[model samples]
Target: MFKHLKSDLPSSIVVFFVALPLCLGIALASGAPLFSGLIAGIVGGIVVGALSGSSLGVSGPAAGLSAIVLVAISSLGGYENLLVAVVLGGVIQLLFGVLKAGIIGYYFPSSVIKGMLTGIGIIIILKQIPHFFGYDADPVGDLAFAQVDGRNTFTEIARVFDGISLGATLIAIIGMAILVLWEAVLGNKGKVFKLVQGPLVAVVLGILYFVFTQDSETWGISKEHLVKVPVPDDFNSFIGQFTFPNFKVIGEPQIWITAFTIALVASLETLLCVEATDKLDPKKRTTPTNRELFAQGAGNIISGMIGGLPVTQVIVRSSANIQSGGQTKMSAIIHGFLLLISVILIPNVLNLIPLSVLAAVLLLVGYKLAKPATFKRMWDLGWKQFLPFIITIVGIVFTDLLIGISLGLAVGIVVILIKNYQNSHFLHIRKEEKTGQEVVKMTLAEEVSFINKGAILKELNKLGDDSFLEIDVRKTRYLDHDIIEILDDFGYKANDKNIDVKIISERGIIENPKDYEMFFNQEKKENLKVTR
Candidate 1:
């Protein structure tokens, strides 16, 4: 760990910069106290990082859950009552880990996953536009098109123009320019600038602008346009920021329902991020899916107890960590500590940083995730790939994350079933057999399911009179009961058509010497026994 500190320290600084605004933003999106988001981020980084087997995966409050959290908090009565559901959600997630439900993540198609990343990217850019222009119509993390303020995504941007803050707009442009310059030029100059990320520089400049331009008549930033971390004047006030769950909600049915929803959604999001992060990892390290569930459950439980939003492995933060050269979980843990220290020691200063600067930071992050090159790449792969990708994106943008993923998965399954229906078996019509009879040979694949029933039945029905039929199952390892029944019934019909039938497989031979049904259902017959 010490040897990797040189790498981890810089990566931690970058991740810290990335995580801060997100923590605040997600909390605001959730309609929970802004401090709750910070606590969730801290716990996600520290507790989950300590418990998880993943070396590079970072956990935190996710934008994907914002809409759900918003609804749950309101439906459950308030934030205090919702905390109970968060804790219960953790218990459910723990059970999921014990039940080995992590494999659910593997069932999602690649196109859907890519679509999710791209969809989220597009949402971030859309939601941040108002903030970048200095209007605070919505919270920083509100990704949904329909916001709590009754303004939709597009309407929020439109509203920004009506009450634009010139000072904030100017600072945001300057911050973005500084960031662009840092990445394009200054970053390549030396290790010092590389260690100091663009976001950090932009934030410092934002703070200076806020302090210096307060007295300016023409260009002055307002309090609403700045970061809004709660300032604790004393130690007691700092402790007061934490809120505990009300266990009385345990008796409520709706509380249980909300708990289950969170557990399912959070587990799914975490598993998906784990898979995506592994793919992004240059070392290709696989995170244990079950352990990840357990770690997330624990993090959520702790976060709920301490007044925080639910936690999940977040791809955005994890990707930032990887891009910043994080080599181990040390970077994640360090970022958590940084969050803790920053909120405690520099809460006032953090509050001074302009909201516009954070918006600019997220704009760059969003662009990387949903680049034009990515769309072109998906399109080049053909309709089978592009359809699911586009459907997922459309669903996510219009509905929500879970709905989008479900739609994409449904499309993917249909594609698979169609391919299976087409390639169920191979039929070759022979001109003559050894006995000089018109013969038809059908070769079964490695595994036969009931899905192949219609295709197989149609081919078997086409045999003409005085024909020989050979059904080959030599490559088959598993045979469905329906298929076996289909073949048995076909034998009786084939015999009436003056067709002679034979079955060949690794299990040896069965012929329609008599009723084929007897051969499979023989009580004590030794003749039809498997050769192996």
Candidate 2:
């Protein structure tokens, strides 16, 4: 992990900048103490990163869980009680790893996963718009369709026009310009450009801009636009910010429910981050899902014990980590330590940086996740893939992340069943055989499920007058009861069409079967069936 120290160091610096505001923002959104978010970020980086099999993925307090955390804290009586749930949640996640439940992440369709990344990208961009304009009524990282602030991404943007801070807006614009220029122009100049990342440069410039603008008599910048790191007077005072969980809450059944909720949601979010991070990795490294679960569980356990919010592998930070050229887990670990040290040593220095500048950085991150070209690429793959992808995108855009994913999964499963139904039949013919013609032989596939009903029904309807239809299931290993009932129903109608249906199996061929289930089950037991 330390082998690429040169490459990883720069990346860690980038991730540190990207993570700072988000850590604070998610904490605020969760209604937990602001310092708790920083604790989660630090532990996520150091503890989870050290243990994680994923070299490039970063973990931290997640925006996705803010709603759950908010509700849990209130319902559980207080933030202290919520910590108990977080600890229990970590234990549950550890059990999930032991049970090998991480494989469930693989069952999600690729299109849906891609859509999720794109959806989150869109959400990030929308959520940051208000912050970029210096409208900070809503927390910086809230992603819900509706927020506790009584507004949403669009409504907040509308409100931005009324409450815009000129100072913060100007700083954000300058920061964004610097970032764009660095990436688009300066970075192409030579090796020097490659050595310094645009975000780092933008952050440095932002700090200088803040310092220069601090003299309101001359530059006219307001203190409200500046970063709001809580500054304690002394070491002892700063240590007072830490809160301990009330262990007495552990006896409550609701606390356990909250714990399970946190565990399930955090695990899901982590799995998603793992998928998105893998896609973003330049080296295309695959993360071990079960190992990641274990790491996250351990991190959450530590975080909760330390009065932090529950931790998860967050895609926003991980994406930033990849974009910044993080090459190994060490980058993640370093960034965590950076969070810990910076907050302790230079809370005032951090406060000098404006929120708008951080917003600019997040804007860039959001754009990369939901590029327009991604939509076109998915469409080119055909409807089977594209439909679910679009559903996921639209669902997430208009609703919440989990709902959109569930809807997309449902659509994807339907598509899969339709495709299987179309392919289930052994033969496709234009016309049935003529009267007394050589028997029209049809075979069935190995495992016939309920989804194959339509195709089988259509094929059976094609038999001609005075024809013999040989329904062969000799190779079929399993036949659904629904299909067997359909066959039985077809037999009664066969006489009207002057057709005879014959079932061929190990029990021997039978004409015009009376009891379809008995015949099928008896033949299934006796026949050396050949699966199609």
Candidate 3:
């Protein structure tokens, strides 16, 4: 993992900066103590990275599961009880790995996966807007459609007008400008520029800004806008901050249910992120899904025991890892240790960073996820692909993450069935070379199912007035009952259109066609049916 030490160091720094705010924000959203987020981050980085086969993927406390964690904690008695569930959840995930359930991640359609990433990106941007404007009523990293504070992304923005802090806004603007300049200009200058990441620079500048404006009461920058790292008076008191899980809760049924929920959701989210990170890898590395699940399970178990929120492979942090030039597991490991050391040794220094500055960093991350080109590319793929993609995007935008994905999956499945139905048979209009006449030929394959009804109807509609149509079933060994009924109905309709119908089969053409049902029954009796 440390094979590329020099190259991995800079990337680790970038991921560290990106993860710091997210860890805190997600913890706040989950209603868990803030330090739990850091614990998860530390465990995810060191434990998960050590066990995982993935090089660039970064695991941490996810905003996606915050809502679930919050509800589970309330229903299951308390945060410590929830920790018992989390530990059990980790065990379940390990079982999932043993059962090889990780393969389920491979079945998601590419369009839907892309849509999910884009949707998450949009949500991140929308959620960060309030923080960018110095609005701290909502948590910095909440992603759910409705926040615990009884406001949503849009409503929060609307409220900003009534409660604007001039100093916070100005500091936010300056922080954003510095971040933009570092990324857009300075970042490309040379080796030195590349060594110093934009996020780290922005954070440093934010602290300096706060220092200069600390005594300026006229600037409107309140204490609320600044970072709020909990400070313990002494070393012994600081050690008391860590919470331990109540082992007695292990016997409860609700704890088991919560455990299963966390395990299932966290594993699924991690698998999806693993797939995404693999796609973004410059070296095009393929991650082993089972190994990733095992790693996540291990990380979660350790995190839960120590009073941390559930950990999972998070795409937001993994993307930052890749974008920042992370090349090995060493980078992820380093970042994890960084989280541990910083919270322990430099809690006071961390407290100086303004929330608005961190918000600016996330705003950029969000913009990159939902770039304009993403929509354009999806549109160019045509309706079959585009419909589900757009539906997923819209659903995610209006609803929440899980619901939007479910809607898209449903639409995508329907489209697949429709296409399979259409392609099940062959419809063609042929011209005889010898006789200069056009003849319509409809050929049913070796087997036909109910899904073929639409194709049959479409071909029937294409017949011209007073034209001869040939329905060939010579190659068909079995035909579905529903399809036979449709043909009978089409026969009746053919007479009205002045179209002459001819049926060709191994049994020959039927004059009255009264025995059509008999032919179907005979095929079924012969045990002739087509498998998918």
lDDT of 2 by residue, 188-249 (tens): 79866767788888887788888876776544456676677788899898889887889997
Model 3 clashing residue pairs (backbone) = none
The TM-score, computed over Cα atoms with residue i paired to residue i, of candidate 2 is: 0.91
lDDT of 1 by residue, 52-113 (tens): 98889899998878888888888889999999999999999999999999888887888889
Could you estimate the TM-score for every candidate?
A: 0.91, 0.91, 0.86
RMSD to the hidden true structure, all candidates = 3.0, 2.9, 4.3
Clashing pairs in 2: 474-530, 475-530, 475-531
- Candidate 3 Cα lDDT to native: 0.82
What 10-residue stretch in candidate 2 is worst by lDDT?
428-437
**Model 3 stretches astray by more than 4 angstroms:** 430-440, 443-450, 457-532
